[model samples]
Target: MSLQKALLLCSKDAGRFILGTRPIPRPGAGQVLVKNIAVALNPADFYIQKLAIFVDEYDFPAVAGCDGAGTIADLGEGVRGWRVGDKILYQSHWNPDTAAFQEHTLVDAVRIAKIPPNVTCEQACTLPLALATAAIGMYADYAQPPGSRSGGAALTEPWAEGGRGKYAGQPTLVIGGSSSVGQLAIQLAKLSGFDPIITTASKHNFDYCRAAGATHCIDYHATAYEQLPAAVAAITDKPLGFVYNAIALSKESQDAAWAILAPNGTLAVTAPPLVGKANDVAEDGKRVAWMSASVHVGPHQDMAKRMYGALTGMIERGDIQPNNVELVHGGLAGIPDALSCLEEGKISGVKLVARIADTP
Candidate 1:
C-alpha cells in the first residue's frame, strides 16, 4: 500500500503534526477514494482540540478537518452516483483516515456532492459544513413528500413550504451576519419569506451583509441592544419572529433578542450562548432553539444530502454566491499557521481555504 501524508492529532490537546507515512485507505463499501484538493477550517476544529470532546483516547493520532473539495480517484463496491474523475465536496465527522486533512480520503458516497462547474475547489470547500449547518438548523422539522427520491437524489422540503404559520413574513434576525453560517442563514431566511431580515454585525461588514439579503444591519458592538427593539418595532411592531443568533450569545444579547420578539416567536442560536437564566426564554413565551450542529452527527445524513443538492442547485443558478475566501498558500505546512490565526479570531469576513492538491 502506498503511504500518504496527513495532519494528525495524537491526543485531544495535540497541536497539528504531520504523519509522513500512513497507509492510504481503500474505499470501503459505499465509499469513494478522493484526492483532496482543498480544505476549509472551522472553529470546531480548534475547540475540539482545546476541549477534548472525542471519547476514544485509543483513537489517538486522529486526523482532523471536516470540509474538503476533491476528485474521485476510485470508487468502492456498492457505491453508485459517482464516477472516477468527478469533482466533489464533502463534510464528515468520521475519523481522520477518512478525514479531509489527508492527501487522500475515503468518504462515504452519501456525504459527498458534486462540485458545480462554476465553483472553484477552494470555494466548494467552504460551503459544505457551513451550508449543512444552516440548512439543518433552518429546516430541522421539514420532511419531503413520499416517493420524491428522483435521480438517486433526495428532495428538500423547506420549513416555509410546510406552512409553519409562525415564521411567515415574520421579522427574523440573524445575530452575526458576517460569519459563514450567518451569511447563509440571512439568505435562507429571505428565501423562506422572512420579512425584514435583520442582522447585527460591525459597520465594516454592513454592505456585504446587505448584499447577502439582510434588510436591516444593526452594529452590535457600537449600538446598544436597547436600540434593536425600537428599530425592530419601527419596521413592524409585530415582534421579532425568528432570531438566528450566529454569534457568541451573551446574556445581554439573548435578553435583548427576547425583548424584541413577539409572543411565541422562535429564536435559533448557533453558537454556545452565555449560560444565564435570562438567555433561556423569549419574553413572549417564544421557543429558544439552540442549534448544536456538527458534521459528525449521524442522524443528519438525509438532511445533509438534501441540503447539498439544494445548495448546489442554488450555486449553479447563481442564487447564492460563495463566501469571501482567502486561499492559504502553504499547503500542508500551512495548516498550523492557518489554525493559529483562526484560533485568535484574526480571520474576519473571509474564510481561509488551504489547497491540498493542485487539481480538483
Candidate 2:
C-alpha cells in the first residue's frame, strides 16, 4: 500500500486539522478510488471542527471534507460503466478513508457523476454538497408513507417523466439566494417552471442570484427579513407553495420564509427548523422538511444515483451551471483559513476550492 498526504482532524476533540500521511484506501465492491484534483469547503467543515458533529464514530485523526472532483484512479469489483480515467465528481461519506480532504478517497461508483466536457475540476467540486442539499430538499419524496417525510418537499423531480415544468406558473421563494445551495435551488426552481422565482441576497449579489435564474432578487440588507412576506406578496399574489431556506440556521430568515408559505405548502430547511415543527402540521397546513445532505445514505442513495445520471447531460446542455469558484491557495493546507472566512461570513456567492493534488 502506498501512503498519501491527508488533512487529518488529529483528535476526537476536533482541536485542529494537521498535515499527515495515511495509506491510500482501496476501493471495495461497487466503489471507486479517486485521485482528487480539487476539493471544496463548506460551513459543515467548520462546524465539524468546533462541534465535532460528524466525527463522533471515528477514532482520532479523522479526515473531513464533503465535496471533491477528480479522475478515477481505480475501480473495485462489479464497478461498471466507469473507466479508471473518467473525470468525475462525488460527495464523501463520514469515514476518514472515504472523506474528500485526502489525496485519494473511496466513493460508491453509483453516487459519482461524470464531469461534463466544459466543466473544470474546481467548478465540479462545488456541485456535490450544495446540489445534493438543494435537490433532496426540493425533490425527494419523503412523504410517501404517512408522517415519514424526512428530507424533502415531496415534489416530483425535474428529471422524472413529466416532472419537467411540473410546477409551471407556481411561485417559490429561496432564502439566501447567493449561497451555493441557494443558487442551485433557484436554477432547479426554474426547471420546475416556477414563475417569479424570488430570492433574498446582498445588493452586490443581486446579479449573481439573477444569473442563477432568480426572477427577483430582494436585497436583504435594504429590506429587512421581517418584511419578506409583504415584499413577496407585492411580486405575485400566488401563494408560495415552496420555500427553500438555504440559510435555515438564521431564525429570522427561517421565520420570514415560513410566514410566506401557503396552505399545503412545504419549506425545506438546511438546518433543523427554528420556527415550526419539522414534518409536523401547523394550523394552516404548512409543513417543514429538514434536509440532511448526504448522497451516500438511505433514500438519498437512490435519489443521488438518478440525479447523477441526469446531471452530466444537464451540465453539457447548460441547463445547470456550476457555482462560481474561488480557488484557495496551498491545497489542503489552506482549508482551515478558508473555513475561517466562511465562519466569519467573509465569503459569499462563490465556492472556495483547493487543488488538493497541489498539497505541499
Candidate 3:
C-alpha cells in the first residue's frame, strides 16, 4: 500500500495541459531513478504540444522535455559504478515516467554523465539533448549507403584515442552559432582543433559563439542566407570542408548551408534533410547527415555510451562547457508561458531552465 508520489506536467485532455500526481517510478534493470532538480526546455517540447509533432494519436497525459540534471534516487538491479545520491545529467524521452518535465524520472545508466563538480544543475540540464545532437551529428558512424541523410558525418569522435586535435588546421562552420546545439558543436570543433572556425549568428551573439571557439561570426540577419558563401569566403579563404547546420529549421537555412558545402565535405543538420537528398549528393561527394539525436535508439546507442563515459572528463577539463541558462519562473506551472517565448523566437542565446522543486 506504500507508494511515493511525484508531480508531472501533461496534457490532461485535448488542448489542456496540467500538473498532476503519479506514483514515483522504480528503475528497471540498467535504469536508475532520478529526482530531477532542473529541466531544460527544447524546441521539440513546444512543437510536440502545439503542432502535434512526433506523435500520431495526439495522446493525452504525455509529458515533454528531453534534457535534465538531477541526483540518483536509487539504482536498479545489476547497475554498477553508480550509487544513490550521485549527481548526474542525462537525456529523457516523451513518455510520462521518463520525461524531464516531472519531479522524478527513470534514466538509462549507459546514457548519463555524472554532473561535473564545476557545473550547476541548471547548467548541466542544458547539455544532454543539445550535446547529443551535436556529437551524434559529427562523430557517430555514418549510414551504410553513404550520404544517405540518416546518419552522422562519421568523423572521429573526440573521445576516441588520438582523436584530440585530429582535425588540426581544418576549417569548419556552424550555422546558428548561438543556439544550444550550435554552441556545443563549436566547442567540440575546438576540441578537435578545427582552425578558424566560422559560424552564423546575430551580432549580439557573436561573442557568445566566439567564446565557444568560433573565430568568425556572420550576422545572418544582416548578411542574409543567400550571401553566406561570400560572407564565409571573406572570413576564410580556406575551403568549407565541414558545415554544421544547427539551424536547419527552414529550407532557406538548409539551402544556405547547402550552398556553402564543399565537395567531399559533410553537412550535419539537427533535423531531417531538406536540401540533402541522397541523390542530391550522388554526383559530388558533398554529404548530408540528418541526426537522430537519441542516445536510446538504434545505431546511436554505442556512440552514446562512449560519449557519455567521457563527458565528465570533458566537462571537468573544460573541453566542453554548458550553454547559457535563462531561468523561467513558476517551475512546472510556468513552462507553458516560457514555452510561448521559445515558440515565438523571443528567447535567444540562452537555454530556458525550470527548477522542478519550484512547482507549486
Candidate 4:
C-alpha cells in the first residue's frame, strides 16, 4: 500500500490537528477508492475535536471530516453502482481513515452520490451534509412523495405511501436562515410545497434567504423572540406548520417556537436546544418532535442516500443552486487556519472549502 498525508487529531485538546502520513487504503468489498478533491468545514468539526463525540479517549490519532467531494480512482468487488472515473460526493461520521481530510479515501458505495457533470466538486461538497439534514427534516421517509415539486414544479408518483408527502405545504419555519443547513432547509421546504416558509436571520441575509426560497425572513437579532409568534401568524395564519431550528436551541427560542406551532404541529430541532436536555417530545399539546440531525446515527444513512439522489437530480436540472463557498487559499496546510476561523464564527454565510489534493 502507498502512503498519504492526512490531518489527524491526536488528542482532545483544542487546536490539536496534526498532519501525518498514513497508508493509503484500498477499497474493500462494496466500497470505492476516491481521490479527495475538496473538503468542507462544518461547526461540528470543531465540536468533535473539542468534545470527542464519537471517538474513544483511547482512540488517539483520529481522522476528522464529515463532508467531501472527489472522483473515484478504484472500485472494489460487488460495487456495481459506480465506475473508476465517476465523480462523487459523500458525508460520513465514521473513522478518520475514511474521513474526507486525506488525499485518498475508501467510502461505502451506498454512501456515495454521483456528481453531475455540470456541477463543480466544490459545489457538490457544500450540499451533502446540509441537504441530507434538510431532506430528513422535511420528509418522513427517504422517498419523495408523488405530486411533489422539485423546482417549483410538481412530480407525479414520486414516492410511496407513508413517506414525505405527509409533511408537504405545512408553513414550515427554518430558524437561522443564513446558516448552511438553514439555507438548504428553505430550498427543501419549498421543493416539498411547504408554503410560506419563514426564516430568521440577520437583515443582510434576507435577500439571500429569499433567493433560496424563504417566503418570510425575520431578523432574530433585532426582533424579540416573544414577537415571533405574531410575525409567523401574520403570514401563515395557521399554527406553525413545522419548525426546523438549525442553531443551538435556547429556552426562549424553543418557547417561542412552541407557542406558534399549531395544535399537533411538529418541531424538528437540529442542534441541542438551550434547555440543556436530550431530544424529546414536549407535551405542550403542540405535538413537538425534537430530532437530532447527527449523521452518525443509524436512521440517517438510508435516507441520506435517497436525498442525495434527489438533490443531484435537482442540481443537474438547475433547480437548487449551490450556496456561496469561500475557497480557503491554502491547501492542506490551510486546514488549521480554516478550522480556527470556523471555531471563532468568522466564516458565516459561506462554506469554507479547501482543495486537499493540491497539497504535497
Best by lDDT: 2
lDDT of each: 0.70, 0.90, 0.84, 0.71
What is candidate 2's CA lDDT for residue 40? 93
Query: Taking the tens digit of each residue's C-alpha lDDT, what string does model 2 give over 1-360?
Result: 799999988766658999889999899999999999999999999988888888878876888899999999999999999998999999997698899998999999988899988999899999999999999999987553346546789888999999899999999999999999999999999988998899999999999998989999899888888898999999999989899999888888888988899988999999978877668878888889987888887777888889999999998888888899999889999999989999999998899999986689
Q: What's the distance in Å from true for residue 182, model 3?
A: 0.6
lDDT of 1: 0.70
Per-residue lDDT tens digits for candidate 3, residues 129-203, read 999999988887667335444577778888899888999998899999999999999999998889989999999
Assess candidate 2 and give its lDDT: 0.90
> Which residue runs of candidate 3 sit more than 4 Å off their true CA positions?
1-14, 54-60, 144-149, 278-280
Q: Answer with 2 or 4, whichever has the higher lDDT.
A: 2
Error of 4 at 213 (Å): 0.8
**Cα error of candidate 4 at position 31, Å:** 1.0
TM-score rank order? 2, 3, 4, 1
Instruction: List candidate 1 segments past 4 Å from native.
Output: 14-16, 55-58, 142-168, 273-284, 358-360
**Candidate 4 least-lDDT 10 residues:** 148-157
Quick one: best TM-score, which candidate?
2
Candidate 1, clashing residue pairs? none
How far is 62's C-alpha from truth in model 3 (Å)? 0.9
Model 2: lowest-lDDT 10 consecutive positions:
142-151
